[model samples]
Target: MALSSSSEIVRRPHPLEAAIGDTRVLLDVEQGLYFGLNGIATSIWQRLEQPVRVSDLCCSLKAEYEGEAARIEAEVLAFLALLDARKLIEIRA
Candidate 1:
């Protein structure tokens, strides 16, 4: 799939609490569930603090991870797809 821009994710502190270390932790008050993220996933979330395109995200991941760009891009797309499937993120035109 082609990369697309995504809407900004505004995290509310009231119902969401998160902590990051070796892995990132996300606690959702409404669901009473905690979500964890691997290193690359956590990095992607960190960069998505504002509106950013999928292509840009892949670029950043490659630059920071020192990994193969194409592989990292694919992984990034997959991660983004997972979040999109969960309605955790909004895709913008």
Candidate 2:
């Protein structure tokens, strides 16, 4: 899925999430698959507990880490795409 900063994201309802150390884990009940996320990816997952704009995610991540806006935006979009592909997240324009 093609995504931009303006896109909004929300976690899918069927996944159960848990945190272990610095990593976050998700179980997709229907698919019986496990997904793991670390570091900033975990942060992004946590933020998606509610529907949020990708731009807001970028801003929050930027404040937590030192990086260019464009770079952070790109990485966040990429990670979101991965989760979306796995049916773990819903993306809306």
Candidate 3:
């Protein structure tokens, strides 16, 4: 599903995760698939432990990372879209 700035998102409970150094590894038990997250992605995943608005998530990332707000928001939206595609997150309208 396409997500807007007002969308509220949270991680799905099914993916088992493990932190390895600065990155994170996720295992989808039902699918027997594994996914890896880099530093920035890991940060976003951590925040998704609880439900948060897309705009709020972008704002938090903008505060922590050195980047233009528009670029950060675009990247975050893209990443969230990928997670949504993988069924790793739940989105509430």
TM-score top scorer: 3
lDDT per model vs. reference: 0.66, 0.88, 0.91
lDDT of 1 by residue, 19-93 (tens): 665877766667686778877787787787777877777777777778887788778777777766554566666
Q: What lDDT tens digits, residue by residue, belong to model 2 across residues 7-52?
A: 8898889688788877788899899999999988887888888999
Q: Model 3: runs farther than 4 Å from truth?
A: none
TM-score attained by model 3: 0.94
Better of 1 and 3 by TM-score: 3
Index of the highest-lDDT prediction: 3
Worst 10 residues of 1 by lDDT: 6-15
Superposed on all Cα atoms, the candidates' RMSDs to the truth, in angstroms, are 3.5, 1.2, 1.0
TM-scores, one per candidate: 0.73, 0.92, 0.94
Ranking by lDDT: 3, 2, 1
